[model samples]
Target: MSLRIFEQRYTRMVKEACGSESGFVICMLNSQGNKDLNEHIYPIGTYVNVVDFNLLDDGLLGVTVEGVRCVRITNIKTEADGLRIGDCEMTAPWEFTATKELLYPMDKKLEEIFKRYPEVNSLYETTNFDDPIWVINRWLELLPVDAEKKQEFLQENDCSKIVQYLSGLVE
Candidate 1:
């Protein structure tokens, strides 16, 4: 949920988000290329709320954001300053429910990861070990999967595919 804005061009967008009433920004990973960001971004992205921003030790902008929900982005446009804008329609949050039995080793293993990497732990103020959606989503984020795979999983109407995928990893 935290992001480091290093590029000077992108800092303006963060600052503007801070000043906005909602403090929300839609974020998607940029693919490799010299193409514009609008061309590189995936159709789905997380709309995050800017919780805090500070100057990092390395003189970059360190921003802590909270993921609000998923959105499907469309109708991309570009500004003169090279900023990409798009229409974001709120998409349903992945309706995955997890019981203690389903979460099993994955929940415990995630705690181990947090303990091993405090930097990752510090990104969020709280974590819900009981929330199946949260556990699976966090695991999904940690997986070294391709963007296409991740996007395809998110686009599903239910979590059966993801459940199978995560079960394979957790076991």
Candidate 2:
């Protein structure tokens, strides 16, 4: 996934992460920053691997990061430079099975849709349509669902449900 950090305050941290062997951490806060720091100090986040980065003329540092896994922050402390550091524990990754019986028709349907809408094909240039997980995840991304609904589906972790949902959407 791509992460765009536009704030000027994070430029140094982003540059340092790009240079380091260990990449960066991405957190999802349950609430806005108005909460007491001690009340919700340690938030869960994703540990990511930086694939590549570029400095843009607009002063925005563009970085491409692939999520490694989910991590829960057990403890957090911020440095003097305003960088937040955390001690985290890796959470169990999502589990799913991609049966060929489930994937065959899905792949065919996706191909048909792509043919009808050639403009969107570029998004899947490096994706493997034959892989059921990839197909489902890509469909989830392309679907016109709201963010909250998409997040719910992602957290569900049931591939069959996702496949069924997409199949219905395709219909």
Candidate 3:
């Protein structure tokens, strides 16, 4: 949840989230230079709850955020401050059903990765491995994929597809 605010578009959004009661919306743009706000960006994003804010010695802002839920953004607009605002439609809480037994292998792989890296485990001490959604998000965060690629997984409503994708990555 430590996000480095490298882009101007994100700086204002993160700052505003620090003061807002509802938290912030983070939509992943397809391209870094994509200035077209009218273009349909990915609908899904993690509604982040800003827990801690710090101004690092390197002059970069380090934000500690927690994913509250998945949100679908619509009616996006670019503000004068370069921050994109939108109406967020929150997705209902999702958990893996018993039918998706294919997730078991992905779950095992995630457990193995965590056990092999205590540093990673310490970062996710509060995570519940029993939840498939949690496991998928953790894998997405840990994987070396770009933001847009991770956004692709987030947009998928089916947990099995995400688990399958992660399993494929590990395999």
What's model 3's lDDT at 39?
67
Error of 1 at 104 (Å): 2.2
Candidate scoring better on lDDT of 1 and 2: 1
Off by over 4 Å in 3: 5-11, 32-34, 38-40, 99-101, 144-153
lDDT of 1 at 91: 88
Q: For candidate 3, which ten residues in a row score worst on lDDT?
A: 31-40
TM-scores for all predictions: 0.84, 0.64, 0.78
Q: Model 3: which residue pairs collide?
A: none
Local accuracy of candidate 2 as per-residue lDDT tens digits, 12-94: 66777767877677765544354335333335567887787776778667787777766767667666666677787776555
Q: Which lDDT values do the candidates have, in the order given? A: 0.79, 0.66, 0.74
By TM-score, highest first, what's the ranking? 1, 3, 2
Model 1 lDDT, residue 89, Cα = 87
Candidate 2: residue pairs that collide? none
Higher-TM-score candidate among 1 and 2?
Answer: 1
Best by TM-score: 1
